[model samples]
Target: MKLNMVLDNKKTILVLALVLLSFIGIGSLLPEELTLQRWVAAFFAANALVAMALTFVLSTRLEILETIFRGLDRVYKAHRWAGMWSVFSIFMHWWLVPQSETPRDESSLMEIGSDTGEWATWLLLALVVISFMRILPYHLWRWSHRLMGLVFFVSVFHYLFAVRPFQLFSPAGIAMNVTAIVGLAAWWYYAFGKSTSKHHLAKVQNVKKENGVVSFEAKPLQGRPTWNAGQFAFISVLHHEKIAKEPHPFTIASSQHQGVARFSVAGLGDYTKTLYDHLSNGDMVRLDMPYGRFKLNRSSSPQIWMGSGIGITPFVAWLQELNYTGALTSKSCPNVVLYYLVKNAEAAIFAEELQQLTENLPSVTLKIVYSEEGRITPERIADDLNGNVDNAELYFCGNPEVRKAMQEGLESLGMPKNNTHYELFDFRGAI
Candidate 1:
C-alpha cells in the first residue's frame, strides 16, 4: 500500500495504540506471580472492551469524527474493523482465561458480572456472525444489528462489577469508564437522535426514469442541508407504511447552490429495485444529508477524473458547482479531463447534459469511454495526458476493482500515488 493509503487508515492505528496502552496500564496492577496465560487473557479482555467502545463511537456519525477520520465512509470502515477485533478479542479472552471450579469469596456483584460476561459473549458472537452472513435479508440483518447496543451495555456492566485487578482511578479503569460512557452516549444518539434530529423531510419532484436509472429532485420541507460537490446522502421514501424505514446512501447529483438535492438511483439490489418501482412525484422522503469527502483538491496541476457506472453522479455535481460558481471563467483554473466509463452509449446517464456542461466550461474536456470498444487503462490515460502524467492529479469514483487496477497501473507508470484520490463506494461493512 502507498503511504497515503496507510495515512487514510490512521484511525485504525490510533485504536491499536490505545489497545496497547490500555493493556500495559492494566498489566501494571496485576500480581507479578500470575501466569503468562492469565496476563495475556487479561490483555485480550481489555482489548475487547476498548474496541467495543470505539465501535459504538464510530457509529454515532458525529461531525468531529468525520473530520478526524477524513470522511464518514472511512469512519464506517474503521467501525467495521473495530467490531471485528472486539469479537476476536472476546474469543481469545474466553479461551485463555480458565473458569474457576470451586466456590470462592466472590461478592454478589462479581458473580452477576461473571454471568453477564458469559451471556454477552454468546450474544456478541452470534450477532457478529449474523452481520457477516450476506444471505440474511437486509431488513432482518439491520433489525438484528440494533441489539448490539444492548450487548455493549451488558459488556460494560460486566467490566465494571467484575473482579478486576485495576482500581477505578487507575489508567486502565479510567479509560474503560470514559470509553464506556462515551460509547453508550453515542449509541443513544445513533439509535434515537439520528432519526429525529439528523434527518429532514423532503418532497420529491421531477421524477424521471431513463437508461435504467431513476433521477429525482428533493425539495426540503424546511431548511436545506448544506453540502459540497461530490458528497452523498442517505434517503428513505415514505411509502405505504410497509416499506422499511432504513435509508440508502446515494450520491448527490446536483450542486449545493441548487438549494434542492438530487439523486440518480440504479436498481442494483432488492431494496433499490423496490424503491425504483414505488418512488413517485410528491412523495415524502427523509434525507440524511452531506456525507463524504470526495471534493476537488486545491491544486493547480492538471486533473484527470474518471467516473464509472453510477459513479458519474459525483462528477456531475462537481460540474454543476463549477457552473454555478463561474469557476470555468477563471484563468487560474486547472485544466480538467473527465472520462465517463460505461459499457455502451446507452449506459451513459446524463450524456447530453454532461456534453453541454463541458462545452460551456472551457477548462473541462469530456471523453466518453465505452467498455464494449476499449478499456480506460493507465496507458490510455497517459496518452490522453500527452505523456504529461508527472504533474497531473487523478480522481476516480467507481467500481472498487477498477480503482485497484488503475492505482497499481498508475504507480507502475511512474505516477505519484498521492496524486490520486478516490471515494470507496462499498459500505457493506457499515449499517
Candidate 2:
C-alpha cells in the first residue's frame, strides 16, 4: 500500500484512540481499588460502551467525515467492525459481570437499573445476531435496527444506578451517560427525521432508455452543490411511496458544468425495476448533496481507469470534465488505459459514448471486453500497462468480489496496493 493510504487510515485510528483513552481515564478516577474481577469487568464494559457509541456517531451521514475516511464505504467498514466489537464485548460483560458484582445495599431503584441493564444487554446481543445471521427481510432488519435507541434509553438508567465507577456520576459515569444520550438522539434523528426540504428538490426533465439501463436527467428545484466528476447523490422519488422514503445512491454521470444531473439505472433490483414504467418526465424527486472522494487521481499518477457494468458511470463523468489533451487532474496527463467490461453487446449500455470519448481524446485508449471474452485478470492489466505497473495508480469500480480479486492480482503484479482506489456502489450490505 502507498504511504498515503496508510496515513489516510490513521485519522480514523486517532479518533478511536482518543475515545478509548477517555474511557480508561474515567474508569481510573474511581477511588476504590479494583479487584482482578472488577478490573476485567471495567475493561470489557468500557470497550462495549465505546464501540456502541462509535456505531451511532459514524451513522450521522455527514459528508465531511466521508471525505475524512476517503469514502462512505470505509466509514461503513468501520461501523461494521465497531458493531462486531460491541457484540463481543457485550457478550463478555454478560458472562463476567455477575461474578464481579459485589453485594450492595438493597434499593428498589438500583434493582430496577440492574435488571434493565442485564436485559438490555441481551437485547443488544440478539440484534447483532439477527444482523449477522440475516434471519429477517431487509426492510424488517432496518426497522429492528432502530430498536437500539429504545434499548439505549433503558440502559442509560443502568449506567447511572448499577454500573460501577459509572454509578458514582464520576468522569467515566458522566461520559457513559453522555455517550448513551447522544447515541439515542442520533438514532432518533436518523430513523425518524423526515425533513427533506434541505435536500435539493429535483424534477425529472427526461428519461432515456437503452438496453437494460435507463438514463435520467433532472434540474434541481433549488441551487445544488457544485460537485466534481466521480461523485454521487442520494435519490428518492416521492411518488414511489413504498420505497421513496428510502434514498438510493447513484453515481452522477454528467459533468459538473452541465445544467442538469444525470444517472444511469440498471434494472437489477426491486426498486430499480419499477423505474422503467414509473419514472417519467416532470416527476418529483429529492437529491442529497454529492458525496465521494474518487476524483481525477490528483495525488497519484493514475495510468489505468477500469470499470465494469454500471461502475463505468464515474469514469464517464470524469471524461466529460477533461480538456482537449484528456487532461483532468492537477498534474500533467498520463496515458490512461480504459477498460469497460460487460456481459454482452446489450450490456454495453454506454458503448457509443465511450467510443466517441476515446476517439476524441488522444491520450486515452478504450478497450471493451464482453464477459465471455475473458475475465480481466491481473496479467491483462500488467500487460496493458506496458512496464508502467510500478507507479501506475488504478481507479476501479465493480462488484466487490471482482474488486477483491483485481486488487490481490494487482499487488502480486507489482502495482502498489494503495494505488487501487474505488467507491462502493454495493447496497446489499446497507441497512
Candidate 3:
C-alpha cells in the first residue's frame, strides 16, 4: 500500500524475475535463426539504455535534485562506474548481435556514429574525459564539467529517437523510454525552469572573525525554511557580480533561535578568499534552501563526529542544534563525541565556544588533534575510541583522503558499516 512497501527488496526481486521472463518470451517470438545469445545481448542492451541514463544522472548528482542544484558537493565514485557499465552494455549489444539474421534497420554499428546517435556518443565521450581528467587545471575542469547537463539532454534524445526497439520490438521499451523522458523532464523543470527570476537572500547582518575563520550572519528576505542539523545552504551576496548567482554550500553555524543564519567560512580559493576582505553588513544576498542527508536526525544511535579542517561545518551545525534544543545539557541526550583534526591551534575555529559547550555537556566530548604538531595514525582513532566504537555511530565530514582513512580506521576498529556516514565537500575524484 505504501510506496516503500511496494518498492521493497522482494518487489525488486519480483520485477527482475518478470524482466527475465519477458526476455525469454521475446526470444521465443523471434525467428529460430536468432540464437539465444543474441536475444540476451539485445535484452541487456535495452536494459542498459535506462541504466546508463540513470548512471549519468546519478554521477552528475541529478537524482538528488535539491542537493546538487543547491550546490551540495557529495557525489560518489560509484556514480561514474555505473555510467561506464551503461556504455559497456550499449557496446555489447552492438557487438553480440547475430550478423546474418540481424534486422536491416537496427543491426548496423555505423548507426551509432550517425546523426541520431552522434550527440549521445559525443556527450558520453565528453563526460568520460571530464570525469577522468582530474590532473587538468581546476578552472578547465570546472568549465568542462558544466557541459555534463548538455550531454545528459543529448543522451536522452538519443535514447528516444535513435533506439527504435521501443516501436519495433517491445512494449516494455516504450514504457522505459516514457519513464526516462518523464523523469528527466521533471528534474529539468525543478532545477531550472520553475524559478520566478527573483532571489531570496535578505541581508548580511554581521561579520565576525574568530580563530582565523570569518563568520557571516544573514537574515532571509523571504522567511527561512525549517532546516535539520548538519544541513547546508547555498549562499550568494548581492551586487558582487563575480560571485552572484554562483551558490556555494556553507554549513549553518548559528543557533536557529537567533532568527538569523550564520556561515563560518575559511578563506579558500577564488570565492571564499574575499569573505572578510570585501563582505559588509546590510548587504542583501540570495540563500538557497538547505540540502544534505548528513544529519543526526537520520540515525538514532549515539554519534562519533569526525571533523578535519573546515569540514567541521556540519558538526558545528549539529552542536548548534543541540545547544538550541537544550539537549547539550540534558543527561538523557545521546553521547556525541567530536574528534576535530586541525593543522594547529590557530586554525581551530570557535575554540572558546566549543570548549564552553564541551564543559557544559557531560554527554559531549571534544578531542582536538593537531596533525602538524602530532601524528594522527589509525591507531590514534582506536586509542581515542577507548573500547566503545563498535557500538557508536560514525559521521565524518572532511577531505576525501581523510574521510577514506577514517572510514578504514573505524571499520578496522569493528565499527558497523551501516553506522558510518560521511559528507564530501568537493567531489573532484568522484564521478
Candidate 4:
C-alpha cells in the first residue's frame, strides 16, 4: 500500500500531536536526577491525556470528522486504537513516574484531583475491557461504554489541578487544556445536545427472509436522507424489546434515488439472528445513515470488485445506481467485473438480481465463485484481465483474512497498491 494510504489523516494528526507533546513534556519536566526516566514518564502522562481527549472527539461521529477520516468506519477504528493507547499510556505513566517518600502540603482541589485520577484510571480500564467483551449484549455494552466520557471529564479535571511540571500558562499546558476542553465539548454534544439528530423515523416494509439473508425496505416517515450507493446506515428496531435497540450498520442495497432505504442482512451473530427472527413489516425503526466511503471509483480504468458472502450488499447498490442513472447503457461506461464469493449457490443472496443487472449492462460482468469449486485467485483475475492487472483498480469487502491474501497476491501480480480500495467492516470497538 501507498505510504499516504497507510498513514491516514487521523493517524497523521495524532502522531504529530504526540511528537510535539513529547518535545514539550521532556523539555519542561526536567528533573535534577534521573532526568531521562522522569522526562519519559511525563511524556507518557501527556500522551495519555491527549489520547483520551482524542478518544472523546472521535466518538462524537461528527460529519466533518467522517470526511477527514474518509469514513465513519475509519474514525471509529482510530477511536478504538486511541483508547487502547491511552490505557496503555496511563499504566506506563503510573509505573515510571517517581513517587515521593515524604508528604507535601497540598490544597483540597489537588487532593480531590489526585483521588479522582485514581478512580478514572480504574474506570477507564473497566470500560476498555467491556469494549473488548464481544459476548456482551449490545445494549449493556453501549451503556457501559458511555461512562468513558465521564472518565474523560474527570481526567481533564485531574490534568488541571493535579501537580504537574508546568504552569497552566505554559505552551504544553495550554495545548493540552484546549484539546481536552474540545473533547469534553464533543462528548457533551454526543451525549446530550445531538443524540438523535441524525436519526430518520422510518417504518419497515417488504420484509423477507431467504436463505439466511433478511432483506427489507424502510420508508422514511419524514424526509429521506441522501447518500451514495455503496454507503451504509445504522438501524435500530424502536418498538422491539427482544431485539437490542443499539443501531447496527448494514450496507444500503438500493440506489440513491430510491426514496426508501433497503438492507440485506445476514445472520452473522446472535443479535442479527434474533433481529432476523423478530423484525417485521410496519415495524418502526430509527435509521442513522450515510456512513461508509465504499462508493465506486469513476475512473476510466477497468475495475475488479470482490465481495465475499454478505459483502456483496454494496455491489447490489452500485448496480441499482448504474441502472437507475442509465450509466450502464452509456458509451463512457468502463469495463467492470464483479466477483461474488459465497459458500455455494444457495448462500449467494441476490445472485439472480446481480446476474440480471450484469446482463443488461454489457460493460459489467458478474462472476460467482462457490466455495465447493474454489476461491477467486489472483491468477484467475489476471487471466480474466488478459494479463492487464496493472490498469485495473481493485475493490474488496469481506473476510479480513481473505482481503489480506488477495491484496498481497494482487500486488505480486503488478497491481499498484494505491489502485486498490476497501473499508474495514468492523465497528465493534467504538467508544
Q: Local distance difference test, per candidate?
A: 0.80, 0.75, 0.62, 0.80
Q: Encode model 1's per-residue lDDT on 81-179: one tens digit a residue.
A: 889989998889878877888796555888898778888899998898888876578767777778888888898888888767567777667877887
Error of 1 at 293 (Å): 0.4
Where does candidate 3 stray beyond 4 Å?
A: 1-41, 55-79, 93-114, 134-170, 183-187, 194-199, 209-212, 274-277, 297-303, 327-331, 377-386, 427-431
Q: Residue 13 in candidate 1 has what lDDT?
A: 76
Global CA lDDT computed for model 2: 0.75
Q: What is candidate 4's lDDT per residue for 1-431, written digit by digit as tens?
A: 24445666556587558757764664564443446777777677778887877877888887888777777877888788888889998888778877666675565788777677777888888888778976667778777777788888888888888777767876767877787888788777766676666789999999999988899999999886888989989888897868878788888888777777899888888878987898999999988887887886655678888988888888888887777767544535557889999999888877898998777678888899998988789899998888888867888888878888888898899988667778875777544
lDDT of 2 by residue, 71-129 (tens): 88777777777777777876686677744367755566877777777787889878877
Cα-lDDT of candidate 4 = 0.80
In candidate 2, list every pair of residues with a backbone clash.
Answer: none
Q: Worst lDDT window (10 residues) for model 2? A: 323-332
TM per prediction:
0.90, 0.88, 0.74, 0.89
lDDT, model 3: 0.62
